[model samples]
Target: MASPASQDIKSIGIWIRVSTEDQVRGESPEHHEQRARAYAELKGWHVAEVYRLDAVSGKSVMAHPIAKRMLTDIRTGAITGLVFSKLARLARNTKELLEFAEVFRACNADMISLAESIDTSTPAGRLFFTMIAAMAQWEREEIADRVKASIPIRAKLGKPIGGAAPYGYRWRDKKLEVDTEAAPVRVLAYELFAEHQRKKTVARILNERGYRTRNGASFSDGAVGRMIEDPTAKGLYRANYTTVGESGAGWQLKPEDEWIWTPVEPIVSEELWERCNGLLAARATGRRPAKKTSYLFAGFAVCECGAKMYVPARRGKYVCAACLNKIPVDDLETLYRSELADFLLSPEEMSAHHAAANEMLREKELLIDAAESELKKIVGSENELFDLYHAGALNKVDFGRRHKPLSERRAQIEDELPRLEAERDVLKIGMLSRDEVLEDAKDLSDKWPDLPWEHRRQIVETITDRIVIGKEGVEIILLQVPFGNDDELATKPLGPRFRGDERY
Candidate 1:
């Protein structure tokens, strides 16, 4: 039904829904909200509220909380009218549509479909509602048909669908490819599974190596086991059926031999994949015992005081052997957490720093161009020297001496070019915006103790070349490089310091 043009629409309610199943789909809830608001404004309707539901099914309106509230608002005369992106979004079932229509009629509110152009205020609009509802049903059926058609084609082509990518491989451009950086970690998983027949042990090994999921999160034992059993690593895709439900008695796994063998860039050999699965099965059937460990940071933490931080024979405290810094484990944890909050720069300081750095980069680019031109002139002179020698215009000894010096000069210029280029790139990055610098500073400071010693050393080296601890405090000396003979470039600090209590 079309709404009466003369009917006043004082307030409107917008409902936006996004199914969790379609979470990976491009459009977000925010996008839907924006569209709804714009449509409401175009109609001169004042938006009263917006109801958003995530990961909820659209098939049944009764199952959704927001859908129930929308119905209640219609019954209580709270909203003058309700607006949705489309009719199917409001209700998928025709019977539910009739129920909502009754509520709208009783509350003196009208139902409007922005996309369908169906309003309940006129007889012609009433006739259009039935057609719009029918069309919505047809559109859904067509979508279902298309999905069904595509699934078979995808399955026949041996393409993975509706699940996360297998370990050691990432999904890209609609195909699976070997993740180079993660290949080594995959190998380690296979080795642990085959040798020790242990899932927890493999997880520990991966954790120690700093290997994480695509989201940079840790994996559980079941996740590791799933990775080992996945057939994709062996360049095959099996269409095995596994029932999903609550009762263990009802669900069973069924093998399908007509498995698709897709050509995937294998991360490990077929033999290794099989061996790991076999060992994993053996362990699952009680053929192997689990290993135990007491130290959480066994292979992860390190002392910065040029000492090997070790757990003493007694317990509960970590001690640095070289510096004799006997810091309790709790103290170290406290320091890590406290320092992060203290050392980061404020947002305002970072913004100013970034602007200054950008200005420096622009100046550096001009200097580099001038230096390159000067270097090119020197190269031309060297070419002239070579030409004279080749024409027998100069003696061999003279030519050799002249060529050697020119060659040395060319090499020097070539080396300097790289340095200048590096300086330019760094300067082009400019100073960190206050937020960015603070974020990074927090990460470094917060995770210092938990970080592996090597990573800690790198962070320290990046920020400061040397740290001399005094009775009063610590003196941090940064590594400042001279850009060139220019006094201005040579004198500047590579990085600005965030003194303990100073704003970023």
Candidate 2:
């Protein structure tokens, strides 16, 4: 039965995303498009657009250009609903599916999946959306965890987990073996360095003799040093020794206890390799001085004249070489601690935020419930109209007139429920996040002095954007907290400057 309420659904977009494998198996994009169009026709909706993600992987589609365009249309109300063959065809990643649902619901748009019989415009369909999305997410996480756990076991067994073979070696039949051409050059690098007692001399000798790296580039001094130091040449190959760091910190070496070493075919004797590396180690030690102790606010503190402040050896203060301005390191840390205490949100403020968020969510929930109840009433009334018509008490025209408005209202309510529920979900997330953020800030403030030097530096880098030392006093500018919008919250002076402070 075509409800008059479906007339409100003006335009719908057909999502035809078929992977290459699916297409090869006879599930063509045209086949999916035809099926989606039929569903739109059945709903009395016009197919105004077709979003085709042909031959695209469903593993992660959000970052795709076509996916971004489709999201823009949903937000702009260009299409009221999206029709697809199934949820898996829409997205394989669980998180992306939920994101799609939220976007559709928030826009008062519907998602129709023919294979799953899912229509988000209905109350039952809305509930199924949440449950199905959760199940999918759980399944994906389980698979990911299993894969992560197997990595260490594979490393211990000397199996290739999945990375390119190291230089001067190749994986043949899943076993590591020395490359015929590169192995000789690698061994020569160690021998030449030990003979000449100079890294650059070895590199120059290799290049002048027409020898090149694996990439066909002329050998460099640093390349020679690394090649001589690698233990793979001496038969013992190390695995699971390094990992990627946070925020582009680059690769970092793992602890020695976690490192796994497997004996491989040697290109050079262990004694020869160790002798070459010993020379390089001695050169490094003799040339470079010991590193100075790093202060907490080394990079963050800036002089009033816009120059970076530095701490000289045993000076215990940040000195600006340009304008000759200086501030004691201890005093600056005290001011930072005091300013951080003031930055924390009060208990009453947190309570007010939570109360407002909860109240708003409650209003949306009540609206969804009321609409669901009204939809039931509309269904009952339609059944009564059918009975009256069958009993010959009413003519066909009279029955149609009475049924049209009720059908329209029922359709409208079904559409309204999902939108209300989506908004409520968004509010709930924000409210919960604020509470956690405020709690973390409180913990950091109370335990400032107890934190380690490295931990304190990380905290300062995350929260404090910059610190300015002026002739008047020091000003600490902090980044915006989750509860507030202002990013540059400058504080008053905590104390006076140190003795013998020079002004510009």
Candidate 3:
């Protein structure tokens, strides 16, 4: 019974979301769907699909798979409009609501909320939607302020404020207690630091003795330093002394006057804690350690047990503190360089790299061409609309209504064209970067002695990802040249010289 013009007008999707409160109130999802479907029918629009978020919280649906599918549908032009019972039903999260609006706007799609009477098909409706998003953002900020205000007060009461208990401690029934298994290791760390007066040395000794952190990770110098500094090990727990900085600036210490300290069971005596900390203070004021010369693969080497290999002061070999695994610096460099040469020089690898690059370029070009063709058709349609309006075929009101969608679509395609072109340019540059990496490897193979230290180091860093030294042999892992699958350096382990027993 629909006219051809009405059938071709709009392809809309229904969005139904019923929260627990609404469900308890006897508001069924089917009620919302039927309302949206009737509205779509009245507007002479096709009901393309129905996206249901039944019983899902509106606070955060952006991470939900159904929500993602709805966004994808909008982007792919599978649905040109979405009809929902209300804005809050779509998402109560201000950020998520704003994100949905932005995505719809970007895709040149409409969002119609029946309750609010917002139809983004018109200019006034778009303005109202913006105002609603701004109000929601304000509400979110108010909630965040309330949460921040409670943190200090909660800390003063000795309640479990938030976050996991410190190392060697666990929370049981909202109370902090020493973890018996980790407590002994924590105690040994302080004793070792008091004796050696070196955090790295203490960490190394603990690791070699088969001791691991509560998280089952080999102890690092930084981890040992933190454990030593924590007052929790000495019968006192400190909180409200630091605040997290905005945007990943990391934690910053609050003023000492505001710090809250509470007493708890001790893992080590305060005397032992003070003695170890005093030695650390003395070392801080003393002459710094001499800077060791950099090796060809200083930070790029790892032990098979997942510990980084480091050269100790006055040592000529990379040592794994965890398992006492050792590999000569020169041997690792020679082995890596040889593997790099084979990877870069092989004809098969070169062919595969070129083929992958070409395939990506071809796909990008096809997309660019399709976008250009779509833009052309939109522009042609705009010309026809103007021609019809001037020739008295369409009146002013009808002309304006029909032209708005075409204009919005043209803007979207115009924005998308440049982005596709930029991606094509990046793919071309990526191919060139891969060629340069190959050239660097070739130069390193032929002119190792003649190249500057910095040049050789740069090449090694670019091509080699890591060198793993184990009891059996060495495994050389190379970084993928050219945005392709990691040409994982041959997994077969190398000779006995790379074994743990080899030492300087």
TM-score per candidate, chains pooled: 0.34, 0.32, 0.28
The residue-by-residue lDDT of candidate 2 on 220-244, one tens digit each, is 9988887887888877567778889
Whole-model alpha-carbon lDDT for candidate 1: 0.54
Off by over 4 Å in 1: 1-348, 359-371, 423-472, 475-504
Top of the candidates by lDDT: 3
Off by over 4 Å in 3: 1-293, 357-432, 440-443, 481-504
> If ranked by TM-score, best first, what sequence of candidates would result?
1, 2, 3
Instruction: Write the residue-wise lDDT of candidate 3 on 183-263 in tens digits.
Output: 888999999998888999999999999998877899999999988989899876777788888886999987654665555
lDDT (C-alpha, whole model) for all candidates: 0.54, 0.67, 0.69
Candidate 2: 10-residue stretch with minimal lDDT: 486-495
Q: Cα deviation of 67 in candidate 1 (Å)?
A: 55
A best-first ranking of the candidates according to their lDDT comes to 3, 2, 1
What lDDT is obtained when candidate 3 is compared to the true structure? 0.69
Off by over 4 Å in 2: 1-169, 176-344, 383-393, 443-504
**How many Å off is the CA of 367 in candidate 2?**
2.1
lDDT at 422 for candidate 3? 44
Roughly what TM-score does model 3 have, to 2 decimal places?
A: 0.28
Q: What does each candidate score in C-alpha RMSD?
A: 27.1, 20.0, 23.1
lDDT of 1 by residue, 310-418 (tens): 5666767655556754445554444433533443434553454445545666776777787779778888888898899889998899988878877887677665554
